[model samples]
Target chain A: MPLRRWSAAAAPLAGSPGTKQIVVARENWRARAQEIAAAGGRLMALWASGPAATGRPAPRTLYAAFVLPPGLLVLTMPDDLAHDEYPGIEEVFPHASRMQRALFDVSGWRSSDPDVRPWLRHAAWPADFHPLIHETAPTAAEEPRPDDYAFVRVEGEGVHEIAVGPVHAGIIEPGHFRFSVVGEKVLKLEERLGYAHKGVERRFTELPILEGHRLAARLCGDSTVTYAWAYCQALEGLAGTPIPARAAWLRALALELERAANHLGDLGALGNDAGFAFGLSQFSLLKEQLLRATHAAFGQRYLLDFVVPGGTRADLAPEGARALSDCAGHLAQQTRVLRGIYDEHAGLRDRFAGAGMVTPALAARLGLTGLVGRASGQAHDLRSDAPWAPYDELAPGKAGATEGDVAARVAVRFDELFESCRLIGRIVRDLPGGTHLAAGLPTPPEGALGIGLIEGWRGPVMIALEAGASGSIRRCHPHDPSWQNWPVLEHAIIGNIVPDFPLINKSFNLAYSGHDL
Target chain B: MWKTLRQIARTGIVTQPPPTGDGSLRLREALQADIREILGRALCIRVVDSGSCNGCELEIQALNNPVYNLEGLGIRFVASPRHADLLLVTGPVARNMDVALRRTWDAMPDPKLVLATGDCAATGGIFGETYATRGRLASVIPVDIVVPGCPPAPERILAGILAAIRASHAHPRSR
Candidate 1:
């Protein structure tokens, strides 16, 4: 059978269509960003990784931007990109500040921003160790220094600093946060991540293309389907092989199950954070039910490794489809009951409503994307907009709001949960039947750059794959949505009482490891 | 009052399930068998992160969820090596984490088992042997079993642990 190709231009006007391009001034990044923003493009991401060229001594800095509906535009600096301290886009996109600092530390590329504070390099390794460039084995003598975080100064008589952990009471990943405050109101928040940086990006270069799928899947395990599929998509684009229709359908089913599971658990956890045990119990139960259904279908609760390059590992049985349908019906019914509880609980409503509100202006300036971005009025879902296999045919609905507050985020998640349930049902009902995987992928073309953009549970998971010698990955960058939203959390907590930080923080649920990569 | 009673009748008025079998008995049985296999006879686990993004930790965490109920199997994760029976590590052993991984292995007592969870842990899955990694977990720590998936399903993880325990017991002279 002949292969099919979907145009990136097929994306809806407001969907996530991978890379968006815009030209920024050479060294005057700020000026160029203003020009691009004025032209209606958003500063989606900024990073400086790798050398100017293969085996080159100079660092290569790439400042990327994306516009509404999806197009990725990148401005690669000259060989002197490292020497030229690019003007920071912090003044305009505020969120780019941390990424700028990260680029400086990871690639040794300097950012002209005065806030020269490190973002991810918590001094976990020696100052001389730039893993992205130099090739030296790690030693036992290396020590992870205690993070010395400097919160943004508010300069008030009663202002004090509250530092939270790289370790917390909850069963969550490690990351530190410092809050500067006066009384109970937060003035500023400084985040210290990379405590869980496991050196994922560098490791990709060593694995074979076939094995890279597993590594990508773990980038954000909850969205294993999305990560694996995205990684596979990039590899296939490099190899130029087509994924089987049955495998594509299975991947969709797995992805929808993943999305539904996360949304259910997150919504419940958000309610739990507000002391709504009823909502937590109900949602957790539903999430558990959903996972069980997934296990029945895919042999895993979280659907890990179900997707591989060129297709899925297994086909879904009709029994599995029936189980999914049954699970969806029960979950929807239970959520309806829980929704009333959330609405009736004045105490819960009070904490959630108007809390951690990000105005539309702030969201736009910061380049927020995903549900948190969508909640703040950025309606972009890769499935509906970018229209990848399964989603392309089904055209899933996206839920968004302009409230830009914790309440809005909660509403968006709830709406997404319901929509995901429907998507899952649609997928199972219309599942294609055939071999779930292809015999093998074609040899990856040398020096090809393949980019994959998929809507992960948190948001868009972008993977850029560059093939190297012997079909091995050269530079694989997995950018988690956390890079775009973590800064927004700091801004969201401002003017809000310090006690509600957990509630606010869970609303974003950014991954420390994902960002550290 | 009556409505509440009706709701209870509709959804079942209990947070607890039966001690033995439930509607998900097959899954429960499989999970239990995995737990029994992986954690048989005071198993010691040493977590090695070959090189991963950390998405697998979610499913690893799910192992503790009330539904899957990992603790019910008597299998526990230990922080140090002196008391461990099995090593359950994730990742492909990033260049930076390689030394830490080896040292952690050396600290463990002899007759200990190693189970590599997630694809990275198994074969440098996504984070292939880049400039940073020294290959997969087995390169650093002798792996008894390799759970070959990006992030093995929690049940699969449970299965991996079981397999590791069986491999260790069956071939005490292999290591």
Candidate 2:
């Protein structure tokens, strides 16, 4: 009944296996978005594709994917370049405001939303110039001007602004945070990102479809394995290539290892933010050892570019599997002890508990996903909800906490670290015997589209790939969960003290480069 | 507290030996000599990410782990560039971050060293000269040392920092 209200035609995704595509009439786009939201579907990603690949004088297509519990539902609507305007669904989905702004800036489509302040266009180029449009390019007449971003002003007695960096004191990726504070209490926190935007989506068009995985892997250094896997899934699906069973299992193994490494690092950093240097030293040591083991197993420390289209670039030797198993066993033991110490430490607990709380209702309203969402009772894990290949077999048990605070996030990370360790152990023990590489993939017909939705360590990392005529990438959009989670950080920081900001932020730890791209 | 202490006692001294050769020894010796001759007994470093993927940042953080013990070498990261002796910069200097990077460079006092880490910062590794990126740290500011890898290892980053310190001492500024 809910599905019949707005969709003109609905069918399963042809090239992409796990999703369904719904074609809505241009006039019914907003109505369909409202129907999806009314049915409690969370907006996973919102992106727009340029008309360059569809020949001259074509309309740009805007796509929005919603997670509808059973599966993913995608809606597509076209925007004519003449009008350059579309119905904004921000009223239905509050998180759609910034996404619409970003889509407008890149594709030159204006949304109906009144908040027209630039999201990604930070005055590096002219206001009229849009990057994703093939016809538009910055000319000599359009010189770079000073970027005076009109940050939302907070006015009152003793209300002042504290601006933190695009270049921070810590060795972190660039993003400016403007906090409207009175004394130490933060009234509002506004983030100005996109400083690390490297035009990744535009670069995807230039690379061969098969080689786009390399660029995807570097989308965010910490989530390399997840991004690479997601990209490969989309590419292989579009090409209708069936990867080897062994390769699928091995990819899961790498993903779990990557998850464990990140969780370890975050646990330690969270401790360090709470003034426990000992935890940082110990956890950092464990993370280093785990990375070394990963390097030995995968031939790359960060597992960068290891997962390519069709299959993986490298195979896991028997000796490497054994080493990985042993390393996982050791890490499990050490992490258990560290978790205990973190739990018992009063100072750490004091700093973590009840800090930067995001209620379950707030999380659902904002469409938060991944680890941050899980911490706040949004128990939507793609691994359990919609499993493909190896995860379907593994059936990873979901881990979640409903407290929605710094402690809850930490608890979720610990649970995930343990779960991922278990996963790695099982994957290596049940390592399949076959070729790791899938060969002879036939390219899909031109204009064919594929979608990949994988439960990355942080959350669901989705990649939508469209194939060009000559085995080239027409367009690719790798959407990070950070896009949905970054705005929620503002709500999380409300009423929290300035000093506690770092600790709360470390718990979420949304990737700046990932979101900026 | 007791548990932490017990764990520390059990894992007594897990500090691995400083890397040898691989150009690390020579750089360390040069740095020690330069510190003794020029500035003092300690070095304060400030880190900046122009537009990196955070891979180089991870490796830089690894330098402070128990294995590397960067603080034992009398080198520490500072919160402000004004108090820093060396600036460890990463990424391929994004177009939007160019002014910020230059301002950070200018904020450092006289007799400051800049060590550009990672291949992106050294030569704009994969994200070459694009409209969004200016490409490489040297294009924006003077780089005394270049540590090149997609993300150079922690040992290599340590060596590069030492080499930059030695170079800074050799060409002391007139301030």
Candidate 3:
């Protein structure tokens, strides 16, 4: 497990087994982070919590979670606005740069990192105003100002820049891409996201703890089931509510369906990007059929807001289960045939192989998780690695490839799609018999904290929930896997041509709204 | 390619029946007729996502799939708004995307109709007007028609687009 000895100061936080909340002094926090990094620990999530609810003028705490195999280790340190700065872990973890910037923008806690550029804050509000601070009201509205984000320049001969959009030609989410290119080859690529930031974190504080799952479901529409399940898992963990076996199985079913639908859609899109329009038509047809089956089973095509706290909002009826099983069987056969076509297509292979390669070393350094990580030879799946409930029993296979190119990612997706179909069949076949929803959700004691981590179709979606008095949420941070993978996209696009940017970008397919929120 | 052709021959056409002679047929026909009357042939549409969850975008994308085959109805999505006759906008207007959305609306040629798709575009949905959001599509620009659902179905979005075209024809000065 590569577990290291904790210093005497960090001894108090090592109390519990599954998840532990530890407080570290500001002085020792950086040293602890460095030690964890040295011990092969990956930075899972880092965010600043809002002010304490007791109104005792306490310093706002900065929390950083590290993945230590079977469990998560969360370290916290107080950040006083008077001092207004904390040690930056970007030196230890490079990806922490943007996360630290986001924390500073939202919570007024600055990091010592040299890159002090605004991340989520794009001059929509005044520079002084921090949205997460309780003093800053949600009603404050400033006149829209034009934002001039500084893109790190790559100056030399023939280093011309091409700027893309916060709004694109396709009906996808909004994000800007700046490519420094010499002719067709890209010298560097910088992505400016957060155009879809809807103040979801602040909105979470406004909603009741029970109702926050709905908002979580909308955090990223494509991975609604995964997000909602993670949120529910966190809420249930905090409340000490035990979900029924049947409900857990149903959640797994919905999640696997979501995975299958997205994979089908992406497979088609990737093929289309590679200039195979026939694949697009066929795969889109299959995806549509899968979505129809999902609608028949869950009453919603996308299964948005279906998984709520305590348990799921609805259960799969017998007929729905039968329909899902039938669809899975049919999709399995059809996808197998299509997979053969995709593999044999020489043109597709040529475009996909050896393009947008992110070497395994770079992937490990960047701490890329989920399917993208798997494609690049980093095999870490929460279902297998940190199993809970249904997955603990199912024992799903983890897909990977050493090639680490666009083709490897596509192969991983195909492998995952087939595996997800099998998991769905297993879930349906051994469907438990019980009440789908928990009887009642008990409110957790005030100041209680719980973490929910679930492997979404994209990757691990983590939700950290802090319960307030009388069923209110003090703070909730839904960390999407996109946070780690988005930066990898910039690295992956370095040597690729400007034309292949979209193809490479689609291979990673990181969520803009998910990260923005 | 030959295998693909053989598979196509075996499958034949799998497109669903057009919205005609059913409960939604009248609405669909009226919309198609109005769009035809205004443009004289195909309706050129441009989709703008002001700030959405991409749930609505998925449904919008579905309209192009074989089953829906939206292009067969003489409605096609154009790359640029300058060539588009209709602008289909989704999501609440995020403050960051406010300028881009307005620019997109401005870029569309004259006689353009705007359709706000989904509950968020209609009334900002769950992510209401906040520090980062401008609320509904109407708050940012003029919306001729609205399709309201968490994410309105593809058929409903098609209806909304048609209605917007119809409204544009009725007003004539909306563009």
Candidate 4:
């Protein structure tokens, strides 16, 4: 079932890091996707780019990127403009359903999928007016019509639908969750996201390719390092520019720091959700310390604009590297001790152990990926699976568990935290000598396609960039792991009690803004 | 239990130079009197993510950390708009969220203040005035103060909240 194994032997797609690309005919698109699905290739992202965004007279094209056992494989098929439709892979990859819907919303192109519910357009703009294709966009000043988007009904005895939000009780991003529950047990869970969509795909065409990293960093704040790095990676690849050795190591350091920081925050939040306030206090303290150290090292708490095209924004100072290394080491020791406290706590263990199980079989079928997938025995980490530069040399340890529960996810987080600390220490200790930014970076020629894929803290964050007329950004797509994982969450919550939804949701912590964008 | 206690004891109290709403409080005695009369010292805020990159939310959530200890100053994030005295919103106003933002503001009990946090909320940041978004939060809702930064620091968020209360106390009808 494994398609030739994901080794670097297969020719890499032009202007991408170890990812293979094949331009398939529209007729064979579905069959090719079926082959990939049968071969256990995970669908990474499915997006469409049209003439309007690309600034070309050519027909609209559909791009499907998959993670085979060996590495990243991207399949592209140009659309038949007469039909405005392309073959849908939803049957093979169930997660592609939402992506196809979003694809139709962004590009004017439709997919062959049966269920054609509007995903991103929630009665805000005219139904006929597609933002990417159409030149003029609505001001959205007038009152929008109430959304008539129907939620699938589950009619049964004592099965009542409980609506949760586009706006929630807490300070998180907006997304509505409709739960059809019988008493406390959830019968079905459906989500209606895309409330945060700001026409970023269309906006990309307007910005210069060089300035796109800033926008990419802002796509999702927590995953800033990955998003920026991925965008720059695409740009760097297109320009045929290899970043300096020191910049590569520094980028990895920032990435690891981000991962460690997020884990600390989530671990604490999980503890708090499980009624352990003390864990929140301690972990939050540690997270703050890490953030402070990060600020000292990288000049930003969250590293919004650190990873620029060609190389990083700034070089690492000796003192800054030392501070970051020291912080990581300190956090590692504290986390090791605290992880033990969590493991031994009977109450905490009970709360986390059996809640919201996504079985390995279910995970594979539904295409659940990233850290959550790792917990469910889908042992895939881009760092180890498709190592690039520092990762190629450093070889990070992959922490996985098959328990497929909140507890398993927590254990993975703990493992990752320790590993990240170790990785950070190594990166700083063996700092390479070179300029942070590349010298005299050349702009990629028009119509050049490049993709940057990275193992972000949340999963494989990708930015597919195609340079436009005169160094302008043509069509750029930023894909978050949330797109694949969010739908799986609905299945994960099934059979679990309603109150435990938050704990399970937080365990994944999928990006809303990035997905919506 | 011993490990938990030991950790807490060792960590001690990290909350230093806790936010003093002093400058704004002393800026206008009338605004102070308005705060005293209409609002209690306890400022209840309801944060709405109109449509943001979630950078601002990170800082807003950090307010709960021990280092900031936002609750220690009697400011707490409430669950409902009905319970809130101020609306601390983040992100640019997405077209889809515009109605929801209006309804949230409408639902809030009057004499409320609006503090737009981060550059996105202030002026729509990077993804500005798009077809899908209405741009800055103020275009949709009247904002008293804007705490700028890509995602402003936790301290700046606190300062914006205080400044919003002070700014709105003078106008009181900005909501």
Candidate 5:
């Protein structure tokens, strides 16, 4: 099962940072997964895909990625033969439960682990209708069936269930969370997502190559630049094509700008949620200004459509660079000023301190990464850890803090904002003079598996793309960091008053649609 | 208050300009041209979320954002298809969302305009076709105006709204 415990002599090849190799036999996947769990690699995501998105199914491919300290590890299963459902790694890692269920729902594959309920399949469609199945039998459409989701029951005196959205009063995505509470104390919180399930996985087969990037970029709009870059990386990797150096730098610039913009906005919103309106006003204004500069440079704001398969679409002009530099200068200055305000404000401090805290110990156990993880002391940034593209030359280090409270989250954002500002400035100063994009993407080899790991504003976004012959997409698994972080929100909300949920939730700001997809 | 003033002055920037009926004069002319080609009457709009994180939904909801005041433009997002004159969809239309998306399109009355807002909806902008996506909005449903951006700025969103309204007027029954 352990696949002949990795020898000390093989450490060089086994432990290389760019990629880590873990060998597992086809028969002992479940056991190897357990070994991965025992070795502290948290299973982050599970997805199933094949040649076609919908219609006659081919061999179902199940791919799962594990998060290790040094980097990430991925395992693939053909899902073509009948095998016992692999043992769920949830006992060692609670996060793998949902992913196991998702694999079951997406592919007709079953998980032996008992913990099972529908993951993303809402009752809007029939129960028997498995959209991911390759072959479809013709039948008359039946009326949609109502669902009876059996949530875990907790029996106690004065313990009641509080159900809130897939729909809510405030503007947010649709996700139903059931909290079992005793008076004001939350005893348990359970989530039912996929309310906004758009069946993104099934639609991939319907898209041509050139048009696929459009869907990839929107996987999580907030992380548009990251998602697009990851998809392109996979495509380019498959084609064995190198994007122009200038295009690569431009992509990194756009990514960092996006990081800065989101961090500013989130820090302000986190502050606002903690009764600090000034933080909100200042950060929102800064984000708006940053977005305006992005628009000037990239034609539209929020940095969408800026990255294509081969390279970027828009090239930065000279005046645009100056304007961006000017904006960064102003932002960096204001960030310092606001940091003083945030640090000194007592009322804001009272609400933020020790509230919705994710202890460093728990954070590491959960394998939390990205800004939230950094705030909690699990220091890992893909930019530094993975070091892809310009990042290798730049060698940016991960930013982190030990205090895993709302304050730490805010501080993490602040630190990242300055880092982004510096990186953007460096990119502009070291602007490569070359074409923005490479020529046509070459056809892919017969069968190739390419993985792309990008640091989105949210966290590390891992996309594994398997391409068939003639440049068509065979299987793609786009994993959002939210899959690992959303569960942590439930843990963070414990013992906190109900009203402060928004503050805590916003601090994490995980994307539901991205994970659901 | 002094600090606030100093901050504003130091940045040398002001709040976004007050809401103008037509974003700019040329934009207004585009609107007028749309009206002239079609009609100046009120048009019913249909809102569809092709597949987005719902951030755009927030800003779109902010069309009622108190300041941007979208209803003033006669831009309405109708609930049912019988009343809708145009369709505005968001997100990248995830795999599971395809059937619903097609059904939503079918529900709309004929002579309806399709406005794909957000980069995701426009060309499958960011949420590119993975195992999770069907394709761009145009690949599945007919699209008229493609508003490109991850989540377009509110001003650009408003511009897109105006453009969609104009397109609907200019080419009635075209879709």
Candidate 6:
């Protein structure tokens, strides 16, 4: 209650309507996190900043955002650069350990967490040479070497290991999966990611504030709209620019389409993984049709560059809007029938029913979030919880399932798909006529902190932006909801057969590029 | 069962001829003939994401969709590099994945083609040469063909795959 009261008094950030952020003292950092956890608040993101190679001369700082009743509560705690040690929040939020390790890999600052094996550094860089620090000196080993990740072993009779990818069998992103199993039954599963790290955070500093949206858009291919809009929201907030009504509606339209497209693809893939190729064929056709329609309405098929700073890149004409609405209407009807088929399919249901079960208790303990969280009875949807701009007007419905299995996740995706389709039709029809893009604005002041949080297709996609001297980007951290979900996946797979991994994985479909970055 | 059958009947075959613009029909036939002579059966491909944003992977995955019908065209994405004739690599070669990429290329049999799809694969795209990224996949491995786009469309990727297969011939089409 004190944490809420404290955060409530803090200055409000733009775009995040109900959210408040404040700098907390180092002594109160761990205590605050415990308070958040006790109050049933989920940690949205955890990141760190030490001495950087360029422009800024800020001290080592630890930052975290918590989702509470009054929206997101952002906290900042600074540590001295010299010994570089800070309190860890992993005990409070179990998902914080990997994040802390990742931040340490990037910034050379250590967390109090016991597990210190590198998360993002795969021995590509020197183990001691941190990339995010200014005063970092290369300590050892020049040539890049293969990382020998230490996977926790399950030593017992008949217990063996099944080591899968960074290079998976599928046409998907890279991340290594270690399965400690007895025969076909899995005893333990640990994921070693960061193979997809392209130094995105470090690359953020090199970009200008205006051009940051481009890189943000590419943070994750599937959630391009979300990341772009969040980045732009942060930028616009920093610059004190108010976007036109039409652009806001346009953004919502794009977001819904993105949600629908990804859901369609995942549902189809889930079916294929469960040995029902018919679902794959049908959903693939629907998704393809939707993408083509999207391209015709907007410029791009995947909507990679449609969202820009201040607003959208262009306006949707009446005809284009009608076309998109028509497409959505058609998709809505087709998917409704398909959903019925999926529900009635006995064999598919058998495969999906109990596979990869994550009970509500386990989900809450592990800090599960996004659509996956909703499947496990975590009633949190940012569109409903923290409605911003068009979402406030649109007030989209939330869909949830409490079963917390592959079936539950499938059911949630289906419900969301239909909701998104409905939203698309509503947005296009009720779009206010006005200028889409805002006039070119002035740069935000140096040291200004801007936070933008949007409910992406996956979950809440947040961009923490800080302005540098002369409109340079000091640091930009884009956080995906996958960070909270990926750890829960390991829990979800316990006691399940090896073959069902794909089906469960497709059901969750957490972002590798976004999380690993 | 009847409902499922009816749904299938309602949605007949959505697959159609792709728009690859390979000049005349004779040229297309000639290319297919060359592919048949070099490789007796379907062309097998292995897609490796060095460090892409998963944008190119989406389009590449779409190649198997009913519209593009990549498998129907005598091309299939296989699990292992050993079975693949063409290695489809995407994204800027992240430093971490460099060794893995090399091992994948090494695993493939002789007379193989490496098609670096997307601008990132071709020239490291937006996340260019940096400490963490060794830009342009060729810095890590030999690139045979480059399909340029932020992410080239599914149709374009299909065209690139076909071209890679035809170009995979030993003693050479260029010669």
Q: What share of the true interface contacts does each candidate keep?
A: 0.20, 0.66, 0.68, 0.80, 0.23, 0.78
- Clash pairs (backbone) in predicted model 3: none
DockQ-superior candidate, 1 or 2: 2
lDDT tens per residue, model 6, A1-517: 4865776667787656666778888778898889888888889998876466677777677889889875888888877445457888888899999999998888888888999999998878776777778444353333568889888889999999988988989999999999999889889999999988898888888899899999999889999999999998888988989889999999999999999999999999999998899998999999999999898888789988899987898789877888899999999999989988999999998999999999998988998999999999998999988799989889999999889999999999999999999999999899998799888878999888888999998999999898888989888888999999999999999999999999999999999999988
In candidate 5, what are the lDDT values of residues A411-436, reduced to their tens digit?
88888889889888889889899899
Q: Which stretches of candidate 6 lie above 4 Å from their native place? A: A80-83, A135-143, B21-37, B167-175
DockQ of each model against the real complex? Answer: 0.16, 0.57, 0.59, 0.70, 0.18, 0.58
Model 1 gets an lDDT of 0.68
Better of 2 and 4 by DockQ: 4
lDDT of 3 by residue, A72-95 (tens): 788988764565578999988888
- Residues forming the 10-long window of minimal summed lDDT in candidate 3 chain A: A8-17
User: What are the per-residue Cα lDDT tens digits for candidate 1 across A45-160?
Assistant: 66655652233333354645444344555544444533557667777777778878877766666767898876666544666666677676455333323445565666769889
Check candidate 2 and list the clashing pairs: A370-A459
Classified by CAPRI criteria, candidate 2 counts as: medium
Looking at candidate 5, what is the lDDT of residue A446?
A: 46
RMSD of each: 8.1, 3.8, 4.0, 3.5, 6.6, 3.6
Assess candidate 4 and give its TM-score to the true structure: 0.95
Cα lDDT tens digits for candidate 3, B18-120: 4421223122344345444667535788888777888899999999899888787677988888888888888888887887888888888777667788889
Whole-model lDDT values for every prediction = 0.68, 0.83, 0.82, 0.85, 0.70, 0.86
How far residue B12's Cα lies from its native spot in candidate 1, in Å, is 3.3
Candidate 6's TM-score reads 0.95
At residue A121, what lDDT does model 6 achieve?
Answer: 89
DockQ of 5: 0.18
> If the candidates were sorted by their DockQ against the true structure, best first, what order would they fall in?
4, 3, 6, 2, 5, 1
